[model samples]
Target: MRLAIANLHASLGGARVLRDLTLTLEGNHFIGLIGPNGVGKTTLIRAIAGLIPFEGAITLDAAPIASIPPRTRARQIAYLAQGAESHWPLSVTRLVALGRLPHLEPFRKPQAEDEAAIARAMQLADVETMRTRDVLTLSGGERARVLLARALAVEAPLLLVDEPVAALDPYHQIGVMEGLVAYARAGRMVIAVLHDLSLAARYCDRLVMLNDGNVFADGAPADVLTPANLREVYRVNAEVTGEGRAMTVRPTGQI
Candidate 1:
């Protein structure tokens, strides 16, 4: 699958948040969208998910995503919002089952295929042990994993997640990131908005660096995460060590 965004512009409360943004994304790799706060990473994900109105064009596999019916679009893209929370006290399995909504008939119970999908998603997210627990009762990190399990249940061709590892300990953070990367390597598209520069550099196959509502750099981690770019956009002193997937990012101080 391919997502094409051209000349995209978005406004929030009469203020332009994304300015002439454009990019094309293909499946089968983990893509990270990184930028300073208020640079429109969240807005960009919203636009791509068809959750907001935007100017210019966004298409999936040559068809305008805006023109696709909501149900069909839902099947094409699975979106996980930033810091997602569940208000209902639904069981974790029940919550994860919601991802199959687009595939099921109204008022229908989950079919065998849906059951398989839910179980697979839970296994991948390492939330199977908590399947019977109430989502509201889980800890911050546990809830994050369950929500991620819900998103993964969709098994959509394209996955757009906002901060999939926001509230987890370092262990689970790396675990979730590894799961996302493995998901992409299994031939799914995973695009996430990540604030942790080191993790983004280490996991993402490509990094799209945004600044002031524009793409400042787009390429391999080594090329885009330069000391100069970090100083200018992130206002941090950082360095990259090693190479390839084994690379590590170390931040020394503020610029």
Candidate 2:
């Protein structure tokens, strides 16, 4: 499966946020979107998910995503918005099971397959222990994980997650990234907006660096995370160490 975005433009509150942006996203890999704040990473993700209106075309499998019905679109793409919240005080399992809505029949009970998918998603997100707990009662990190479990439960062809690890501890951060990487390796597409450069470099198959609402660089982590690009775009000094699968990026200081 493929996702194609062309000449996309978006605005918020009469302020232009995304400019003429175009990119083609392919499946079976973990893609990381990274940039400084207010660069339109969230806008771009929302546009692709058809959650926000844009002035350009976005297509899935050569068909315009805008024309697809909401339920069908939900089946093709699973989105986890940044700072996502649940106000209903639902149990973790019930909330995560909501991912199956795209596949469920009206007024129908969950089938065995739905239960299995929910279980697998919770296991991948390390939220199975909290299955019966109320989502509102959980800590920020725990809630984040459960929300991720909800997204993963969809098992869609494409996963669009915005800053999935932002509130997690070091251990859970690693855990979430590892789960996403494994998910992509299992032949699905995972595009995530990540602020942590080191984690992005360590886990992403490709990195798209955005600046001024446009793609500044898109390539392997080592290629795009150069010290020169860092200074120019991020206004920081950084060092890239290690090679191949073992890589670490350390930000030295401001430029």
lDDT of 2 by residue, 206-236 (tens): 9999999889999999999999999988999
> Per-residue alpha-carbon lDDT of model 1 for 1-255, expressed as tens digits?
899999999999999999999999886999999999999999999999999999999999999988999999999899999989999999999999999999898889899999998998898788999899999999989999999998999989899999999898999998899889877887889999999888998899999999999899999999998989999999988877878767877779997
With candidate 2 superimposed using the best TM-score fit, by how many Å does residue 79's alpha carbon deviate from the native?
Answer: 0.6
> For model 1, what is the alpha-carbon lDDT of residue 118?
96
> When superposed on Cα atoms, how far off is each prediction in RMSD?
1.1, 0.9
Name the TM-score of candidate 1.
Answer: 0.97
State the displacement of the C-alpha of residue 40, model 1, in Å, after optimal TM-score superposition: 0.9
TM-score of each predicted structure versus truth: 0.97, 0.98
TM match of model 2 to true structure? 0.98
